[model samples]
Target: MPDYSLLARQLKALLDTRDWLTNSAQTSAFLMQEIPDLNWAGFYLQRSSEQLTLGPFQGKPACNPIPFSKGVCGAAARTRQTQRIDDVHAVADHIACDSASESELVVPILDTNGALWGVLDLDSPRKARFSEADQAGIEALVEIFCQASDLD
Candidate 1:
């Protein structure tokens, strides 16, 4: 397990600007660089109530406009909860943006007003790449991101 505490501090320091767009891009790059086994790291912003448009990301081209009713990202947006799937192939509604991805983690990004701002998504090529500890750690990192950015 990576030391999340150290990562948190590093992220806090890395976020020198409060701009959401820049921060989101930096955050995505930071996650991809710091985390192991990750093929994709990015954000899906909630432009409409029922859909998420692609945001800053690192990796291959990704699917755009994920609805709130489909896929793991959709599930997280609809439920306002983190969705950690051990195997994407097992999901009946999994969206195969990257055929090489075997596991995924999506954390709902809620603004301070409790409104859905977006979601932070991470994908790995290894099956069961994300553990519960990883979920908690990433969630904590997302929290830091929320606090540091101007998501309103």
Candidate 2:
């Protein structure tokens, strides 16, 4: 299990006064380095109510401009909730941005005003790589991220 408290503290300290781009880049790198069993870690900003444009990510090239009606990221955005899938292949609507990714966790990002912003997406090569604790931890980190940057 990862130490989310430490990660949260470190994330806050690292991104104290950075811009969105810098923070996004660092956040992806941070997740990639800090989290284990992760094949992909990144953010997808909501370009529109129905579109999610790919942001900073550490992994193979990803599918850009995903709609809010498709994939895990879309499901999270559409529902404004976290979508943690144990097996990507098992989900009929799963979009294979990376075929090697067996599991995925997507957390919808809500700005300080509680408006839908984007999502923090993580994928693993192992099935069921995430637990409920991970979902809570990642949600906390995303909260920190939202607090640090002003996303509109």
Q: TM-score of the candidate numbered 1?
A: 0.99
Error of 1 at 27 (Å): 0.4
Clashes of 1: 0
Q: Assess each prediction's global lDDT (C-alpha) against the native.
A: 0.97, 0.92
Error of 2 at 142 (Å): 0.6
Candidate 1, superposed: residue stretches over 4 Å from native: none
Give per-model TM-scores: 0.99, 0.96
- Return the number of clashes found in candidate 2: 0
The lDDT of model 1 is 0.97
The residue-by-residue lDDT of candidate 2 on 1-152, one tens digit each, is 99999999999998866477788888999999999999999999987769999999999999999999899999999999899999999988899999899999999998768888889999999999999999999989988887888686
The collision pairs in model 2 are none
Cα lDDT of candidate 2 equals 0.92
Q: TM-score winner among the candidates?
A: 1
